[model samples]
Target: MKPLLRLVEEIRHGIPSHYHVDLENRLAIAWGERKRKRFDIKPRSRGENLVATRENRARIIYLQAQDEDCLLFLAFILAYSPRSCVDFKTTEFVEFHDYALDNIQQRASPETEKLLKTMAIRRGFNQNLHYLNYMQTMFPKGIREQEPIGETLVSTAAESVGNEMRIDEIGRDDRGRQIERMYSNGPISQVSMFGELLSNAIQSSHQWRKERGLGESTTNCWTTMIPRDPNEDISITIWLGRRDGHRVNTALMVEPTWSSPSLPMPE
Candidate 1:
């Protein structure tokens, strides 16, 4: 199947009757804007080649009608291969869209329906996280976890390991002193257990970073605190890169003030 056709099928399944060729350019524009980047679509001298390429690609568009308001959108799901590009056919495209629509309708409760329009935005974030995870697994060494203060967790962990490897000089430095304290407090020699925990945390953190759009930056930081008490299950905070200062400030400054005071919080 063509990549565009697969995308179309996915979109149809996810979004239903909202697909149209006329809206392809607009959909592409919308995608680029949301990503804050321009898509590289080759310019064609004639419409035939453009249409042919689009048809061969795994893409799906749907015209969503809710009362009077209609929304036309397309989704492209392409997986680049080393040898060649595998595209999705029209049937695959439509099937994917149908799947998407069914998934959406399954969650069409009164409360969820109120947020239905925002589903595409959420889906984009989810897809980004999926891609990030795949990339992390492929290039584990390049995946660095930064602490809140902007130090690499992997480097810190390595230094800690080095210090632990020297058991004779246990209390030589602050790190060694901390290790001594841990050794006295509990079963701290379980290196394998710690490795497993750290590995899981790294994977989870990578997914979190992608979901938050942190990208590949040394300065970005993400933290999550889970209290022992049941009152606070999870608390998350993110610090963006210095280059993203404008975006970070804008997000922080706009959020508290923009929320609807009268709207009930979700359960």
Candidate 2:
């Protein structure tokens, strides 16, 4: 029998790095990369001379995944299942199955309904749908920077500064000291200002800046707020962006029409 990953493309898309498959949960994920810290000089531990060495720092980060279509389709398949299934026992599966069946009964479409009726009775779920990779391709390429989803506050900066924002505390790779990051979003504008004039302008824009569209969020929205580092010099601002899918491994596809829009979306 084909394994779950071979049966479901979403499960295969992220098997190596993004996530693991779950015959029960449909997917299992744990994402918090560990961080390390080091020091130049080591000091005494108990009033005696000690070797100078670096210290390791461990960091915990939160994560969220988006793969609704895969789950929904699975639910639709499992709805008509005669035997119990651990991989697809979610309430969504049962509900979507009924929804599809109801649509069939109503004769939503003569030929289409007939085909769905046949699929509904299939005991095995064997669709190679690459949901994640396809969604990644749909994302706009104009965006180039990404941050974690959250609310952020900043004052309006000068136009010249905004074009070339001087953001200090830029985060850098501790190991290579390259690839800078943000401690916070840049506070800048297209208008140029300096000294008190610039300060006053920023303060005036503070209200709007503080309350900018930092509201509710969606998985498709670019919401990853990259953290900033302390003791870093000012650097030019960068376009915010995101990688729709992790490219740790090449996507193995089962069908070309895996994530086709023509497919029905069972709620």
Candidate 3:
């Protein structure tokens, strides 16, 4: 119950201001702020906006009842909620769940383990096995920014800017806008000419990713040619750091975890 409450609180904090309390609070209240009452509500469209609503109602009922038999049911609901970390819209929800599960498993809670397995079974064959697999990978320790998983090509013109070691301007984007403080690794000129090349490459890569639907310029490793001679192809690496599990969410959206339920299902 405490973990559920914490998860709910996290969703409340992570959502954008527009949907913050307006939509989220309805979930919190409908669940069980007072004595619970059940009623059927009709949907405007093909029930597109209603999955979260139904899940919210169930969460309240379970929370208020504290039914031991329903923990698996509750976990599944909580895991799929748009408010949950799996959705990729709100931040830190997955990490929170991962941390909480680690604590539970560390204490040797078989019931929790059984609950997870049951949820996995339900999700795997009926839905996505990778969902549970990815969730397990995040266990013990969550996705780490220090580790850059994949590299994206920025530009072939690496040597073009390697010599112009503009120390003061390294962190700025192509248009001269300052990069987000967290994403900016201050002037890399002192590191090497390769550093400047990498810095420039990352700027271009961010722009490229933004223009295409490939992914966000949010978190990734940018790689480009670091030439020994003007034509010699060597490479240098520059990592764009992650903020609040941004990379994790992006990864989930990319492959095995990209399992956003179908349009009929609420994202």
Question: Highest lDDT among the candidates is held by which one?
Answer: 3
Give the residue spans of candidate 1 off by over 4 A.
3-131, 145-267
- What are the TM-scores, per candidate, against the unseen true structure? 0.17, 0.18, 0.23
True-structure lDDT of candidate 2: 0.23
Tens digits of per-residue lDDT, candidate 1, 6-54, equal: 5544543344334332233333322322221224595445554544444
RMSD for each model, in Å, please?
Answer: 20.4, 22.0, 19.8
Query: 132-217 in candidate 3: lDDT tens per residue?
Result: 22222222121111122123212110111222211121222222333221111123233344344444444443222221232222
Candidate 2, 1-267: lDDT as tens digits = 123224334322222222211211231111111222334487346422211111000000001112223222332222222122222323332223222222222111233222222221231111111211111212212012222122321221111122121223332332333323222223344223323443343333312222232221112211122334445344432211122121111232233333222234432
What Cα-based lDDT does every candidate model obtain?
A: 0.28, 0.23, 0.30
C-alpha-based local distance difference test score of model 3:
0.30
Candidate 2 TM-score versus the reference: 0.18
Per lDDT, what order, best first? 3, 1, 2
lDDT of 3 at 19: 39
